[model samples]
Target: MLENGKLQRSLGLWAIVGLGLGYMTPTVMFDTFGIVSKQTNGMVPLAYIIALIVMLFTAISYGKMVRIFPSAGSAYTYTKETMGNYTGFIVGWASLLDYLLLPLVNALIIRLYLESLFPSVPPWIWVVSYVAFVTTINVLSMNSTSNLNGFLVIFSILLIISFIIFASIQLYQGMGTGTLFTMQPIINSNVDMVGVLTGATVLCFSFVGFDAITMYTEEAIDKNTVPKAIFLTVFIGGGIFFTASFFTQTLFPDLSVFQVVDDTLPEIGLYVGGKVFQVFLIAGAFAATTASGLASHSSVSRLLFVMGRNNMLPKKVFGYVHPKFHTPAINVVLVGLVSLFAIGPSLELITAIINFGALIAFTFVNISVIAYFAVGQKRYKTGKDIFSFIIMPLLGAGSTGFLWYFLHADAFIGGIIWLIVGIIYMLYLTRFFRRKLGTLDFDEREDTRAVEADVKVSSQG
Candidate 1:
């Protein structure tokens, strides 16, 4: 048993990876396939490839930062420690858009799936029920959440494999393209660069799970496990997205078959395997959404708890960890309340809005790497240091910036308004620069070492 105000360190590598995969929601490839395919003119796989490359560079930066500051705060902690408190607060506030809205996104997707299956039922019923269930599970304990998420993630992956097999068989029988291997999905005569770039921007939302795994650092069994988990989550999630999109795009090769492009999972399933398969696909989708809801809800609550613990938010509400459950109970409930808003928004609107904040967080994490290592630590003297601390992160930052060029207009407007609100609140928090904002203790390494030693001793005894 552990004391209050501390997250338990019980998660192993695969456990962390499971949570990451759960957060990524492997089944999302189907949900967004028709929309992306329409935008890219059946080049969904190409967009995924571009998004994966961008996320890989950012994932490298995340791995480096986690080794230095192993805290639940993630991007906020990294930015604050490396840049300054004010900037850190802004980045964290922006990241809240990604973390907070993600659970809502899951709820929205679930509502879509449920409404498709049961047309007469009201959408709010699905959203409210899902939010309540996910919140209850997350408020219990981290280990329970991880275990449940792991099972769901595995089920979702198996379903993806099933779909791929069915699609492959159809292709071999001259159903759509008649060939499994072709450049049609990657490039064709009608390929548009702008459309592909826009598709890539939207697809970036799928890769947010890799960075989200960093939030579990405080709950990980070993601090070193985080860096490895980050890489695994990125590559594994990317592989799933790319492979699924490739086959689906090849099989359909166009959006004319999908009645609804925004949510095409059901139609894809129906066309590929029939009505029975559609039911199974919906079940898989629900499982995937539930797993993602658990992971995202848990992650956002932790971020709130960390901010509250540092006095950035209301310490009494957000920072209060339940002594019995050892989880951020209040924060968990708070996220659930926010997720109720899913009853109103369109899937495309929410998705584009999420990309705004996500890109900001990704861009800064890459910059934070340079700020911490190259500028602050002066590690730019050696060639290896220059490559690791400077060049790579710069590439990451530049690539992320390129994505921003294609951000939706509504997303930019919404993001700026959120940032302005954050700026006002931050100003009041610090008394207009008259006082220093509260910060996490910088002696995390020494503290981690002491805790590890204590655990070692206890286990031996």
Candidate 2:
């Protein structure tokens, strides 16, 4: 263990990618299928494609920024370093809506699954138990959390493969579409660009995990490994979503088949396979939720820790890392406590609000790339430099902005209210702009010296 409460650098590229994929929660395609399909008029796969394209561009910008400033603060750090302290605070504050609520989202999902399976039990019981277990795991050690998440992610992928195979067999036997390969799922007479864009806005929630991996940079085996992990996570997660959605959409070309539009995973499972398959599907969904809860819980805690370390939040609590666990115990427990709100809000409402914060962070991260490289460093002279520094991030910003135009009205209201609260808190923290905001210290020389001293003391003893 390192001295002075430093995050242990033990995560390799694959581990980080696993956490990212887990954070994305591959099974979410099924959870949100009915709603997105209804919104897009049965073009769920097209919505995924649109979201994938936009996320890819933003992923590139994230890659470039991580290479420059490899820290746990993610978009907040990038924006702070390039844009300014105040803008970065607002971005970070907005992002909290995404990070903070994700664990609650997972808890709510688990409650839904459990209620479907056992309607007799009170829903809050499941939420509380799930949050407690996930929070406990995260508070113990990040390595254990990563390892468990990796295993669960692999298990969830196998279930997705299983679903695809079963759906394929049914389709070949003259089921919904009677055949797999067709452009009908992508586009039909009901195809509407406006609906597809709206669905894409919601689907943007699915891609937020790729960027969340940037928070693990300080804990990664090497800072350089994080950029590669970010791309791999996005591509891998996107492929799974597109493939699964394509087959599922092809199998059921109309939303009339689903009884409950908001929750479709159980129905999809029962329809494709049988009772047995539905049981397995529920198990996989449970695994997916657990994996996502752990990853998101850990991520939000770290983000809180960074903010606390900079005195943006209460330093004594959020900044406190357990000396033995090397984990943000206080922040973990706090997030878990907040997750108890799962009993209050609906999944659709939470997802809409999450997309709002996610889009905000994505837009700013793309813009930060332009601010840091093109304007701050003046590296937009060469062809390659212009493409890498200017054009690429510009496209990223434009794509995310397009999605913002289609954001849900509830999301705008919720996001604006949250942003206002953040502004008020920021005003108080800086004493009405009289005091300057504190900055994050990314230097590692002090940590290195502390480790060296600990080693010397051990040898002397």
TM-scores for all candidates: the values are 0.96, 0.95
Alpha-carbon runs more than 4 Å astray in model 1: 1-3, 449-461
- Model 1, 268-299: lDDT tens digits are 99999999998898899899989999999999
Question: What's model 1's lDDT at 46?
Answer: 97
Compute the lDDT of residue 36 as modeled in candidate 2.
Answer: 92
Q: Clashes in model 1: which pairs?
A: none
| lDDT digits (tens) for residues 386-450 of candidate 2 | 99988999999999988888888999999999999999999999999999898877666764654
Give the TM-score comparing model 1 with the true structure, all chains together. Answer: 0.96
What lDDT does the true structure give each of the candidates?
A: 0.90, 0.89
